[model samples]
Target chain A: MTFVAATGRAFLVLLEATGALAIFTASALSHSVRPPFYPRLILRQMVDIGYYSLPVVGLTALFTGMVLALQSYTGFARFQAEGAIATVVVLSVTRELGPVLGGLMVAGRIGAAMAAEIGTMRVTEQVDALTTLSTNPFKYLVAPRLIAGLTMLPLLVLVADVIGVFGGFLIGVYRLDFNPASYISRTWEYLEAVDVISGLVKAAVFGFLIALMGCYHGYRSRGGAQGVGTATTNSVVSASVLILVTNYLITGIFFSTK
Target chain B: MPDSTPSQPAATPKIRLRGVRKSFGPKHVLNGVDLDVGTGESLVIIGGSGTGKSVLLKCILGLLEPDGGRIEIDGEDTTHLRPRDRERVMRKFGMLFQGGALFDSLQVWENVAFGLIQGERMGRREAKDIALRKLAQVGLGKEVAELFPAELSGGMQKRVSLARSIATEPEIIFFDEPTTGLDPIMSDVINDLIVKCVRDLGATAVSITHDMASARKIADRIAMIHQGRIVWQGHASEIDRSGNAMVDQFVHGRADGPIQMEILHP
Candidate 1:
C-alpha cells in the first residue's frame, strides 16, 4: 500500500510540475509578443547570451571536430576507407555535434547565470518591487531573455558550424597527410543545405528551452541563497537533458528513413 | 478590548479590508484580517514576528491573493482584477520593501526614475530631472545618483527606495519594516523622512513594522495583528494604555505575554 501510494504521489507531482511549466511558457510567450516591449533590455540580453557564449562554444566545437577527424581516420583505416575521413568529420559535425555540443556549453554558461541572477532578485523581493512599480515581471525579466535566447542561439551555432568544420579540415590536411584541396572538395560535396538548416532549427529550440528552464526556476525560487543555488543547478541540468532529448527527436524528424 | 473601527467614517475609506484570508498549504498566514485606512491617513500595523503583518500588507497590495474576502481601494473592488486592470490599479501605489529592494543593476537615479519612465512613459531627460529632485528630497546628492544601489549604505538604499516609491506621486504608499536593520539614529531619520514624504504627497500611508518607536513616530492610528487576525486597533496616542494584553506585550517587548514565542530550546 505504501509503495503504491508513494508512486502515485510522485506521478501527481510530476504532472503538477509539467502543468506549471506549460503555463509559465505560455505566459512568457504571450508577454513577449505584447506591446510595451523593452528593446533596450532585449538587446542587452542578446549581447550577454550570444556574444559572451561565442568563446566557449567555439572552443568546444573546434576540439570536437579535431577529435572526430583523428578517430574517423583510425576506424576507417581498418576498412581501407581512410579517404572518407573528411566527409565523415564534416557531416557529423554539421548534422549533430555542432548544435548539440554548442547548446550544452551555452546551457552551462548562460542558463546557470540567468537562474542565479533572477533567483537572487526573487529572494530579495526585486520582482515584487517590479510589480509594485507597475511593471510586469514577465515583460521586464523573462521576455528579454526569451527573445535573446531564441534568436541568438542559432547565430552562435552557425558560427560554431564553421569553426568546427575548419578544425576538421586542418586535421585532415596537416595531420593525416591528405591532399588539402581534395579534402576541402570532399567536405563540400556531401554537405547539403538541409544539414546546416536543420542544425540551426535545433539550435533555436534548444535556446528557448534553456531560457525557459532558467526563468521558470528562478522566477519561482524561494528560501534565499540556498534556494538560488538550487535553481542554478536545476537550470543547467534540465537544459542539458532537454537539449539531448530534443536533439534526438529533431534528428528523427529531419532524417528518419521512410 | 479595543475596537477595530477605523477612525474615519465608514463611508468609503481610502483602503478597506474585510475578513481577508490567506494560507499556505497547511498553515494559515492571514485569517480574517479586517481593517481600514482613511484618506491622507498614516496607519501602521504592529505585530510580533510571524503574525502575518507583512502577508496582510502584501495581500492588500495585490502581491498575494487572499483565499477569501474583499479588499477595496477608494471604494473600488480590487480583489480580483485582471493583469491589465491590476497594473492600472497598481499605478496608484508605491511601496518601500524591507530590504530597500532597489534594482542593483540600475543606478540610483535610474532606480528612482523607473516608475516615471516605465509606468508613466515619461521621456528620459524629464524623468531624470524629476528623479534628481526626488533624490534631493530624500537628502541624497547628485553625485550619489550616478552610483549603483550596491555602493550605497543601507540607509541610503532605503532613502533611494523611498524616492523611487514617491517619484510618481502615488495616491497611496506602503512602507514594510521601514526601520529594520538600521541604527537608532538612521531609523529615526527614516521615520522622519517617511513622515515628511507622506505629508508632502498628502498620500494615504500604510506601514507595517515591529519597531514600536517607528510605529509611534509615523502612525496616526495603529492596529495590532496576532495569529493572522487584527486583535486591537486605536489612535496611536492610546497604544500604551489600550488595555489589550497582546498589544501591551508587543509594545513593551515583554517576554511573558499571552502571545508566546515559538522558539525551540536546545
Candidate 2:
C-alpha cells in the first residue's frame, strides 16, 4: 500500500479500536455497579498499582517542586520580587505540576508493565482460559485495575502535594534564605479549595486514562512478542497525550476567565 | 482400558459439530469442518502448524464467533448464546493452554482455585483446601501452593495448569499443545497426568496436539485437521490403518503426499 493509504488505514483502525475500548470500559463500569463486587481483588490491585507506585510519584513530585521553587525565585529576584516564591511553589504543586508529574511518572512505570503483561496474556490465551472457566476476565482483571486507577490516584496526589510543598519550603528556606514562617504564610495566603480539588480531579482522570490505554492496547494486541511491544509503546504515547490534552481542558474549566 | 469396555454414547456421540465454517478476513481458517467427541471419551486433535486447530478449539469454547456452523454439546445448540448465558454454559469447560497461562500475581493455590473462588465464590479456606488437594492429585507437593507462577519451573507450570483445569471438576476439558516442548520423560509424565486427571473428572476431552506419542497415550479417538478441515478421524487403535491416504501420510509423517500436492509453494 501507498504511504497515504497505509496511514489512513491505521487511523481508521485506531478509531475502531478506540470505539471498542469505550464500549468494553462501559461494560466493565456497568458490571462494577451491580452485584458481586470483588472487594478483595480490588483492594489487592489498589495496593499493587497504587500504593506500590508512591516512591516514584513522590520522588518526581519532590524534584519538580524544588526545581519550580528555585526557578521561580531566580526569575522573581530579577524584579526584586523573590518573596513570591512561596505562592509560585504552592500554586505549582497544588494546581499544575503535581498531578502532571505524578501521572507522567506512573505512565512510564505502571502503564508500560500493565500493557506488556496483559498483552502477553492476550497472545497466550490466558484471557480465553479465564472465559472458558466461567470468569469474566474484565471483572477479574480490568475492573480491579480500573477501580484502583480511579480511586488511588487521588490519594497519591494528596501525598504528592504535601511532599511537593515541603520540597518547595526546603528550597526556599535553605537556598534562597527566605524566612520559613513567612514562606508557609505566603504559601497558604492565596490558596483556594478549588485549586487542590482540581489537581486531585486531574490525578483521578489521568489515572483512568493511563490504565485504560494500557488495558485497551494490551487486550487488543495480536501476534506475539512484536505485537506486545507495539501495544506497550502505543499505551505510553496515548496516555501521555491524553494527560496533556485533559490537563489543558481541566485547567481551562477551573481557571478560565468568565 | 477401564473405559475400553465400549461406550454406549460412542455410537451416538456426546458432542457434534456440523458444517462449521470460519474465516478471518480473506483467510478461511476452518472450512466446513465436522467433528464429534463421545461421552467420557478422550479425543485428540492432531495437525501441523497453522492448521487452525487452535481456532477450532476457540470456536467450540465460544471464544471466537464462527461465521456458520452448529456446535452441539449433549445435543444442544451452543453456537449462539448471549454473553451472560454463554458464561453459564462455560462453567462446564476447563482449558489447559500451551503456555500454562498461570496468573503470575496469584499464588499457585489461588491459581488452581481461580474458577472456584472467583466463578463459584467459595470461601478462601475451602478453596485453598480443595486447591491443594487438586495439586496433590497432580503430584505437585503441598509446599508449591504458596509460590507465584514466576517461581515455578516449566514442567511445574504445566502441572499447575492441569491442576487448575480439574479443580472445578468440569464436564469438558480442552488441552492445547499439552506436550509441545517438554522432554521425552516429562512428556510421558504429562500424558500420564492428563489420563489420570481426565479419567478422574470423567470429562469429555478435546485435545489438539501434534505429538504422536501424546496422541497414542492420551486418546481413545484421534482426529486430524488440515487447512481448516478434518482430513481424517477414527478410533486411536485404528489410526495405524484408517484406509484414508491423508491419514496414512500424516500417521507415517511423510513429506510427499496429497498434502504436499495441495499446499502452495509460490
Candidate 3:
C-alpha cells in the first residue's frame, strides 16, 4: 500500500509540473507578442545565445563531419559502394546530426547559463524587485530569451550544416583520395530541400523548448545557492531530453512515409 | 492589541492589511495579520526571524499572493487587481531589498535608472542625470555610477539601492531588513540615510527588521509581529514600555520566554 501510494504521488508531481510548464509557456509566449517589447534585451540575448555559441557548434560540426565521412567510407567499402560517402555525409548532417547535436550542445551551454542567471535573481528577490518596479518579469526576462532562442537556433544549425558538409569534403579529398569535384557534386545531387528544411524547423522547436525549460526552472527556483544549482542541472537535462524526443517526433512528421 | 490606526483615523491609510493570511502547503507562514501604515508615516515592523515578517511584506508587495485577506492602498481594494491594474498600483511604490538586489549585470547607474527608463519610459540621458543626482543624494560619487554592484562594498551597495528606490520619487517605499549583515556603524548610517530619503520625498515608508536600533531610528510608528499576527503596535517612543509579553521578551532579546525557538533537545 505504501509503494502504491508513493507511485501515485510521483505521478501527481509529474502531472502538476507539466501543467505548470504549460501555463508558463503560454504566459511567456503571450507576453512576447504584447506591447512594450524590449528590442535591446532581445538583441543582447541573441548575442549571448547565438554569437557566443558559434565556436563550439562549429568545432562540433567539423569533427562530426570528418568522422562521419571516414566511417561511411569504411562501411560502404564493404559493399563496393564508396561513391555513396558524400551523399550519406551530407544527408545525415543536414537531416539528423546537425540539428540534434547542435541543440544538445546549446542546451548544455546556454540552457545552464540561463537557469543559473535567472535562478540567482529569483533567489535573491531580483525577480520580485522587477515586479515592484512595475516591470513584468516575463517581458523583462523570459520573453527576450524566448525570442532569441527561437530565432538564433535555426541560424546556428544552418551554419552547422555548411561546416559539417565541408568537413566531409575535406576528409573525402585529402584523406580518402576521392575526386574533389565528384564528391562535391554528389553531396548536393541527393540533398533535397526537405532534408535541410526539416532540420531547421526542428532547430526552432528545440530552441524554444530549451529557453522555456531554463526560464521556468529558474523562475520557480526557491532557497539559495543549492536551489539555483538544482535549477541549472534540471535546465540542461530537461532541454537535452526534450531535444532528442522532439527530434524523433518532428522527423516522423516530416519524413515518415505511410 | 492597540494599533496606530487610531492616530490617523480620518485619512485612508497608505497601506492597510486586514486578516492577511498566507501559507505554503503544510506550513502556515502568516496566520491572520492586520496592520496599517498612515500616509507619509514611516512604519517599521519588528519580528523574530521566520515569524512571517518577510512573508507579510512580500504579500503586500504582491510578490506572494495571500490566501485570504483584504489589502487596501489609498482606500482602494488591491487584493485582486488585474495584471494591468497591478502594474499601475506598483508604480506608486519603491523598495530597498535586504541584499540590495541590484541587477548585477547592469552598472550601478543603470540599476538606479532602471525603473525610470523602463517603467516611465524616460530618455536614457535624462535618466542617467537623475540617477547620478540620486547617487549623490545617498553620498555616492559620479565615479561610482559606472561600476557594477559586485564591485561595490556592502554599505555602498545599500546606498546605491536606496538611491534606486527613491529615483522614481515613489509615494511609498518598503525596506526589507535594511541593516542585516552590515556593521553596526554602517547599519546606523543606512538607518539615517533611510530616514532622510523618506523624509525628503515625504513618502510613506514600511520596513521590516529585527534590529531594534534600525526600527527605532527609522519608524514614527512601530509594529511588533509574533506568530504571524501583529500583537503590539504604537508610536516608536512607546515600544520599550509596551508591556506586552511577546514584545517585552523580543525587545529585550531573552531566549527563555513565551516565544520559543525550535531548537532540538539532546
Full-model lDDT for every candidate: 0.93, 0.88, 0.93
Question: CA shift at A56, candidate 2, in angstroms?
Answer: 2.2
For model 1, residues B56-129, the per-residue Cα lDDT tens digits are 98998999999999999999889899998899889999999999999999999999999999999999999999
lDDT of 2 by residue, A1-258 (tens): 699999999999999877897897898787766666778888987897688889998988889889989999779999999988889888889898889989988887878888898899999888887887788878777877788888888899989999999999999999989899999999999889998999999999998888888888888899999999999999999999999999999999989983
Model 2 lDDT at residue B26: 100
Number of the predicted model whose DockQ against the real structure is largest: 1
Model 2 lDDT on a 0 to 1 scale: 0.88
Q: Which should have the higher lDDT, number 1 or number 2?
A: 1
TM-score of candidate 2 on Cα atoms, chains taken together: 0.92
lDDT of 1 at B262: 84
In model 3, the Cα lDDT at residue B132 comes to 99
Enumerate residue pairs that collide in model 1. Answer: none
C-alpha lDDT (0 to 100) for residue B3 of candidate 1:
23
Task: Output the lDDT of residue A42, model 1.
Answer: 96
True contacts kept of each: 0.87, 0.79, 0.87
For model 3 chain B, the run of ten residues with the poorest summed lDDT: B1-10
Candidate 3 per-residue C-alpha lDDT over B37-111 given as tens digits, one digit per residue, 9 for 90 to 100: 888888999999999999998888888899998999998888888999989889999999999999999999999
Docking class of 2: medium
Error of 2 at A214 (Å): 1.8
